[model samples]
Target: METFSSIECFVRSAEVGSFAEAARRLSLTPAAVGKSVAKLEARLGVRLFQRSTRSLTLTEAGQLFLREVGSSFNTIQNAVANLASAGGQPAGTLKVSMGTAFGRLFVVPLLGEFLRRYPAINPDWHFDNRQVDLIGQGFDAAIGGGFELPQGVVARKLTVAHRVLVASEGYLQNHAAITEPQDLAHHQGILIRSPQTGRVRSWQLTNRNREHSPLMLKARMTMSDSEADCAAAAQGLGIGLVSMPIAIPFLESGGLQRVLPDWYVDDGNISIYYAEHKLLPGKTRAFVDFIIEQFAEQGLAQRFSAV
Candidate 1:
């Protein structure tokens, strides 16, 4: 019988088209992944992959085998995970992905309490600005805004991903007062370039009275991260469009002040995303529920909202 490790190595290598890339995702050395696949191929008595110096292509038989076992492995893992958590506390590596600044500011603060409550689970968190393949990349969960819901993944919303304009007191004092959205045209902008798109994002602000206005500002500087935008605005570089979660601390510290306070850009909701499995792992469920409960307790949803 082919071992689970060997099967996993073969499937991952097939999906990624290379042993080296599969090894990185599986947290194994390239040689180990290659050896595992070789073992599986030997047992099956067939060439699973047409391995070459530069590439690894799946053979016709390998493609058929992958189609049969690829999804089966995930199902088997989920079943095993469910069983493990059913008889005991949530135990294992809980892998998650989230936006760097938001995770540090909000989610990271909850780690101590979460760990105290569930010590058996070890967290493996990846923090970056872009969305991740929750299932394909083998993440237990992800937290962020504006993710396209892939098949078998669901999002539990946490808070409104609202962006509000902000500027330093010094900068505000020196520049023309911004009492309305149209006034932004006169000020310089510390803009955010979308990490996914690599294009400077444009905002359409909505006021309390269901009024909409386009954001027009002279581009003084551009950054790919919202945290950097806040920092630049705090330094009196220019007015910035900042997410409420990232701006909350700076606003409280008086480093940044809301410009046109009534107007905000609704990007969407920040959510905890997980696989839509019937037998969901306890760690994923626990983390998702805990985050929702904490956000509610802290009134984060209201605090992060502009309207």
Candidate 2:
């Protein structure tokens, strides 16, 4: 049991490259994590990490050992969790990552009901507009689109990441009616800057008939957030291309209306991502299932589709 704990400590330290970070994930003190790793090193008679003041680096032998045992250790942990799950209630801090607006608008609304169903489970969610390191960061799950799946991670898609042109009724009334994609060139536009690229995003609108049209409009405003784009459009600044998840509320309240509704830009799928384990944690499985059920019930996939 002690040997297993030491190995887990070592593997976690290797993953995050910091004993302090690993200790946070493990809910242990840094000194305890360091002591466990030292015990493992003494037992194995091989130094695992090169000690440093500012950075932690794995030695050649440490890297080799990590490669050999990391996956195996995870499998053993999953097996143990599986056994525990079979007999125990889903109870723990369920750490998740999601988009800021999407989490607040969509997922947050369901929290009350979710907690009622699983009172023992506590939610610890992070809202950001970027991809998260699920395993290394110790997140139980993440909800977003376009993640490059890590070795032991899997994604369950929730809705299509479809972007549609939207503008306030006042803006549409003031500007010439945009009946076609080419007519958009005569109107003002609220553009979104890609956080990953640091440049304005460019995409072509595609409709049900598979016809494509380039988005060409005067850039009146540019922002990095989708919610900000929706807000700008709602305030009659310009026609903005926004993802359905972020634009739904404004459209619902009649603050914004879809322009050229038949055409949309397909970015990808919004998905809930988690570690791929057969015996997944009860808390994670419960949350994933609940979200999927809610999305299905709301017909989010059909509603989000531009076709």
Candidate 3:
């Protein structure tokens, strides 16, 4: 097995393009870095670098090897940092990006408690509908939905949210009916335009027998905000699809009523994602644990009936 010390020495040398620079960074002698690289090359049976009197360059094998092993190095670093930080008080900035509605409704309300628990943690939050590139944006983490996460990021599923098709009683009273998904094709559907992609949000629904299908409805009105969609639905404009939590308050107030109770859809899980790094900092770890604990306390899994 290749020693971690040797691998780290090689990585630093490759990054700095010189053994002398790498040794300086790692507080080792240039000869020590060179010896580590030689040992690594011998073990792998491949030349990683080609050295000239003036400069050093990676061999073709080295380029490929570094590409494959960079992430592994980062993971190792993060694991070490996480272990070291255990039981230590969190201190530093925790940068997070999240969707506007979720941030406003859920995350914002819980911020006070998190801050009170870890006063040493300073939070920098960005609320938007746009999907952020966490690494490029220098964010520690993000709250997101959907299945396609970017490469080199670790995604942890936090909670599943149910999407319910709802319409005001007044709207249903005037419309033909919405007993089935196909029936929505003829009715005036309030389309939700995603602020991130500028496309009308589509719905996935399952029937009483658990047969699921994606439905694209005809839209008479389109809005970017869920609150606006709910308002329009309440005014008898059309059927609006929204998360269960958002609809619950309105349902109890008699502003909206659930349609086709036997049918439902999943918006997928809310995930906390971060760049796959060698070491997770103290503040980031604290926030991640806090988020998980809060969700657990709220019975987040049970709320969506997620198994």
Candidate 4:
């Protein structure tokens, strides 16, 4: 009974290599976490950690105990999570909404591994550009930028939505030299038409000195979404302004080169929006944690910074 808490505390401490870190994750004071681990050591009749002022290390016995408890605890948790799962098993359908291009490029691919981890949970995902009413529409979560958050709605930011001007290398070779943000108006531009507002979107580009310049480039084509914007630039239709993530692949392959590489538009942040409630359903919570973990591990947030 009480032993489980001590075991969990010990296991967490070992995994993170610090008692303070384990305490923060468990929502307890560091002293409390240390006491719990001390109790576990007393019961097992062995010193588990070799402690120094600046570092913590596991003893041979501690290593053996951790290997044994960590695996068994996970098995126990998954099993108990079935009947008494408190945001654990995530058995029911997890419904989510996200932008078509972003979902297809990022979130959709993570589904395979997420499903593998929680076999009991089913995913129901919607890929669209329009923002969804999470509560009214019965969606567990939605991912995108610029969604108006009504009362009782919350968001967790995934990444900064920094946008850059890009064009195919071929287009750049033939076009007049583009040296700065204001120079964009002289070239063929691909713009995004807002479906909600029905206006060709405009952006204020900024530099390292925090100075802004408004540029309404002449549009040769107006696309509905970022994928099309990137594709248009890749095809040499025009210089397209879009988020770095959407343009990363083309830029990496040398098909598209950044125009005025030092400048970018601050388009706010991409986030996961969910309805806030006292009790979050297991499925929604699982999906949220999974996505956040994936992002952190892969350094997805840092990938799109100006290069």
Model 2, 1-307: lDDT tens digits are: 9999999999999989899999998999999999999999999999999989999899999999999998788878876754564237677789999999989988899999999888888899999888988987889999998678889899999988999899999999998988899999999999888776778877888987889989897788898888999998988999998888888888889999999988999898999999987678778889999999999998888877767
Candidate 4's residue-wise lDDT over 64-105, tens digit each? Answer: 999878767755644454455435456866779999888988
Worst 10 residues of 3 by lDDT: 78-87
Q: Which window of ten consecutive residues has the lowest lDDT sum in model 4?
A: 77-86
Q: Give residue 24's error in model 3 in angstroms.
A: 26
Residue 194 lDDT (model 2): 76
lDDT of each: 0.89, 0.89, 0.79, 0.84
Model 4 ranges off by over 4 Å: 1-88
**Candidate with more favorable, higher TM-score: 1 or 2:** 2
Query: What tens digits encode model 3's per-residue C-alpha lDDT throughout 1-307?
Result: 3478898888888877899988986789999999999999999999999999878899999999999987788678566655553256677667899877778877888999999998877789998767887764557899877646877789888877677777999888887876677787887778778876789866788765779877756888888876678888898888887766556667779999988777777777788998776567767878888898998998765664421
TM-score of model 4 (CA atoms): 0.71
What's the CA error at residue 150 for candidate 4, in Å? 1.2
Superposed on all Cα atoms, model 2 deviates from the true structure by an RMSD in Å of 1.8
- For each of the candidates, the C-alpha root-mean-square deviation to the true structure, in angstroms, is 2.2, 1.8, 7.6, 15.5
Question: In each prediction, how many residue pairs overlap at the backbone (N, C-alpha, C within less than 3 A)?
Answer: 0, 0, 6, 0
Clashing pairs in 4: none
For candidate 4, the per-residue lDDT at 157 reads 93
* Per-residue lDDT of 101 in model 4: 83
Off by over 4 Å in 2: 83-87
- Candidate 1, residues 73-163: lDDT per residue as tens digits? 8778777875685248887889999999999998999999999888888999999999998877889999999889998899999988999
In model 3, the Cα lDDT at residue 82 comes to 53
